[model samples]
Every structure is written in structure tokens, then in C-alpha cells.
Target: METQARLIVDVARLDEDGERYQGELSLALLDLGASEVFAPKGALAYDLFAQALGTELLVRGTLSLPLNCICVRCGGEFQKVVQDRDFVTSIEISEATDFLDLTDEVREAIILDLPSYPVCSDTCKGLCMTCGKNLNKEICACQKAGSDRRWATLEGL
Candidate 1:
């Protein structure tokens, strides 16, 4: 799911009326296939500024939702709560600030904030490869074999 929001605003007279544009926006976190994870309940607030150099926009927001993925250890379906992360992205927008460029910048910020891999938990007990059992759910009867040949001498004695 996507836990990020993108805002596009006119920087003309931004400093004077930026607060007017600042608002809470709701967004949906989608999966890689663009499927919504849960109901749309994310928010973003931003302040826009019309600087002499260029138009500067201050974007900050949070996305709260349960991220669903397969458990790394148990290989089970699980949902992980992803906390809202505040992100600020600065963009130099001119008369030529097109949708594509703004989207690229927003997409980059979200990708940077996302975790590389989602895990069920910090101490998740994975599955047993020998029997294809979820160690977290049930104990497997696989035995550990002794490797040292010298230990065999003691058995004969």
C-alpha cells in the first residue's frame, strides 16, 4: 500500500495565502497492484510560498494504516500497523511545473520513507523448512543430527 500523499498548489502569492491552502487530505494506501489496503483515512497538511527565486512548498503529512504482507518467518498472512511518518519535500516550481514533475518528486519522497521489507514482527518465529511447518504456530519433530565422529566412540564404550 502507498502511505504517502502528494499536493499540488499554485505558488502565486503563496506566502500571504499559503495558510488558506493548508488542509487535511484523506488518501488511500494501495498495494503494489494499486489495491487499497484499507479505508481512505490518511491526511496531509502543507504551506506554500511564492519566493522570488521560485515557488517553494512545504509538504508534511502522516499515513496511518495496517500494512498487510506475508510473515517472513512463519510464512503466514499478517497485518502490520504502519505508523504515520512526517515528510518534507522542497520543490522549485515555475510556470513549467507540470504534473509529471510534481508527481516524480512526491513519489520519490514516499519511496525514500518506505521500509525495504515488511516483517510481521521484530521477533517472529519463522517456519520449519524440513517439514514445512510454521514454527511459530507448532513445534516440528525434526531432530538435530550429531556430526562429530569422535562422539561415536563413546557410544561403543
Candidate 2:
């Protein structure tokens, strides 16, 4: 069955077992802002269950989003998927709280799950320090020259 997505829960309408919410959140709404190193390729997708637990609302789900990242080692652009499989949170609810928005929770989960230093591959060769060349793509002239300046005198002797 095609279930309609629910981003905002109707607190008053929630049954004893609660309701399931599944949808894609727009990247624009997140206001993640411009990032030099990385950016969201698309919207953040979520599948969650929201239920009432006494005075609190319990939310649990998974979040995943494709990101275009600049490889930290080679400075090359690459695409990666960031996922939060164990997303869980509890929000205190009240009589006046008729609606519970899940946007904030989703945003926080993604931000916390983002990788600090992203790489294109585990075996990335990085870049040539002297000529600023991507070692993974092509070798630099510096590599053909010598290993180090300190070894130049020893080789001549």
C-alpha cells in the first residue's frame, strides 16, 4: 500500500500504538547553508514511528541522504551517502501541544551523523605536496626527481 508521508504528527489524533511517518524533507528547508567541502545532493529521506509515552512523545527512525563531497586527501569531488540508522528521540508533549514537528529532529540527526573527514576511497593516494598534483590521477615531476633534498648530497658522495 502507498502510505502518505507524515512530517508533522497530529498529537491529538495519535492512536495508542501511534503512527508511522515516511517522507523526503527538502534540502532548502534545512538551510544547511553553502559548504565549500560538501553539499547535499538531494533531500533527506526519513522513515519513522511516532508514539505517545505518557507526557513525552517517542520518535524512532532512519535517515539517509546523498552528499557531494570534496575528498579531503585529493581535493577531488565525490559522492557519498550519509545514513543514521539508529535515530531516536523523545520530546516532551503537553495538553497545548497539538502538533509535533519532526524536522528539527531529522536535521540534528543528519548533522551529527555527517563524517568529519570524507574520503573518496580508503586507499586514496592524496596529492603531491610540491606540484599540487593529484597523486591518484597522475604522478608528479617531483616524484621522478628525488625522494628528499637531504638525500641529494648522500647520493652524490
Candidate 3:
């Protein structure tokens, strides 16, 4: 089922302690383009608290989302949960600010927490450069070629 992207709160209902919010938002709200490298497998969950402090409104929370990613090194697929324990955002508010919406902030928190280049494991051997083989699975039959042929004379010295 589809989920809501907006998190609107009425400032009038808030007291000195502020108000707490907990809900799930649509993964599409993140605006991540279609790509096989990475994608969200489920909705993003958030537990947040909002308070009005003088002229500024503060929002702090935790966010969690499951992601399906392809490892950059070996091209293997893996699932990982991206979480941000201290998601915080502040907006300037005035007397005229009766309501606050934090739809974009929630989206940014999840995206920023994701790894730029995901890997299945830190010790992955990755693909062979010349033979086009997965090194982690088995040894390649091709001989190990030197990095540069021009440096052959330097090896004797």
C-alpha cells in the first residue's frame, strides 16, 4: 500500500515539552531515481519529536529503511537497513507559523545516511581485470600480468 509523505503538525497543540510523532512514509518520497545499483525495499519508519523554541522550531528523530543494493566491488546483491539515530532539522518559525511540514527533511535524512558505494563485504576479491572472472569464487587460469611493460628493465635493477 502507498504511504503519506507529509508530516504536518499544529503548533497550537504543542506545549513547552513539544509533541512526538511516529509513522511510516512512502519510500518514493526520497526521490531516488530508478537504478539497479540501489533501491528501497520497504517504507521508511520515523520516530520524531518536534518543539517550538522561541523563533526556531526543532525536529529530532530516528529513521530506518531497508535497502536492496548491489555491491560495487563484486556486483553481488545484498540487503541492508539504513538508519539514522539522530536525524535533526530546524526551521525558522514566527507567530504566523501555525503549522509545520517536514516532508523534505525526512527524505534527506535517509538518502544522506546511505553509503555512496555499497559493498557486500570488506574482504571481497572483486572481478578479475583481464579474464572477467569473480576472484572470490575460484582462482583464475590467466597468468598475473605486470602492471606496465615499460617498467620491465627496472625489475632487474
Candidate 4:
């Protein structure tokens, strides 16, 4: 099942009391082709804040999820555990506010923070370049010739 979460806070308008709320969610990472996301779960907590420039809004919350990452070293998948990730953000929903966007900012932060390439295992032996065989699964018996020109020179001497 997909992970869903709800964040309740007095955003856009400044909350004098800085109200807070929390929720649980289950998220998944599907960009990795040959990998699966387990029971990924996390929580969200937020509050209100006021800046020195008089700009006021809600901020301070955490969103975390456990990930089963593929190891590049071993070609074996494993669980990569992580703790809560705080997203201190501000939202502006006022009639004359322009800083009231959170979805795009949050999405960008998550995507950009994702790993570029995930490996199944840490000690994963990659495929053989010459034969294109998976070295991790099995070893290749391709002939390895020692081409040493010094052997010809010794014969002449």
C-alpha cells in the first residue's frame, strides 16, 4: 500500500501559539528497477515560526522512511535504514503572499537527495567487460594471454 500523510498546521497566516500536528505515512522508492521497498514508514511534525524580517509562517517537521537499497559493491539488495528527516519549511497562503508553496519544494528536495545509482550489495562483483558475463553469479574461463615482448629479446641474446 502507498504511504500517505496529513500535515495540519496554521500555515500562510502567522500562528501566535505555533500549533503542531503529526501523522504517519508509508512511502516507497520505485526508481530502482530490480529493487523493492519494504514497509516504509515515517512521521510528520511541524510548527510555526517568525523570521527576523517580520515574515511569519509555519516550519519545523520531520519526514522519514526506511529504504531497501541495492548495494553496488556486492550486487545484493539490502535494507538501508534511516532516521527521521526534518523538513523545516514555510508556507504562505495569504491573499498577498507568494511564499506559500510547499509541494514543489518538498518534491524537489526528496528527488535531489535520492541516490544516483543503487547497488544490490556492497561486495558485488560487476560483469566481465570482455564476455559480458555476470562475475558475481559465476567466474569466466576466458583465455588470458601474457603478451611479453621481452621473451623474444632473451632468445636473441
Per-candidate Cα lDDT values, in order, are: 0.47, 0.85, 0.81, 0.46
| lDDT (Cα, tens digit) per residue for candidate 4, span 54-129 | 4546456554445666555444556654433666665444545633434444444444444546665557777666
In candidate 2 the C-alpha lDDT for residue 135 amounts to 93
In candidate 2, stretches whose alpha carbon ends up further than 4 angstroms from where it belongs are 1-6, 146-157
> lDDT score, residue 93, model 2?
96
The candidate that wins on lDDT is 2
Tens-place lDDT per residue, model 2, 1-157, is: 5443436888888988988888898877776654777888988898888999899999898899889999999999999999888999999998888988878878878998777788999999999888999999888889877666558878888
The candidate maximizing TM-score is: 2
Worst 10 residues of 4 by lDDT: 39-48
Q: Candidate 3 clashing pairs?
A: none
lDDT of 3 by residue, 9-97 (tens): 77766777898989887766666553667888988888999999998889898999888999888898999888999999989988888
lDDT of 4: 0.46
Report the Cα lDDT for residue 55, model 3: 86
lDDT of 1 at 97: 52
Candidate 2 lDDT score relative to the true structure: 0.85
TM-score for candidate 3, residues paired by index: 0.79
Per-residue lDDT of model 1, residues 62-90, tens digit only: 43333456655666666654544564456
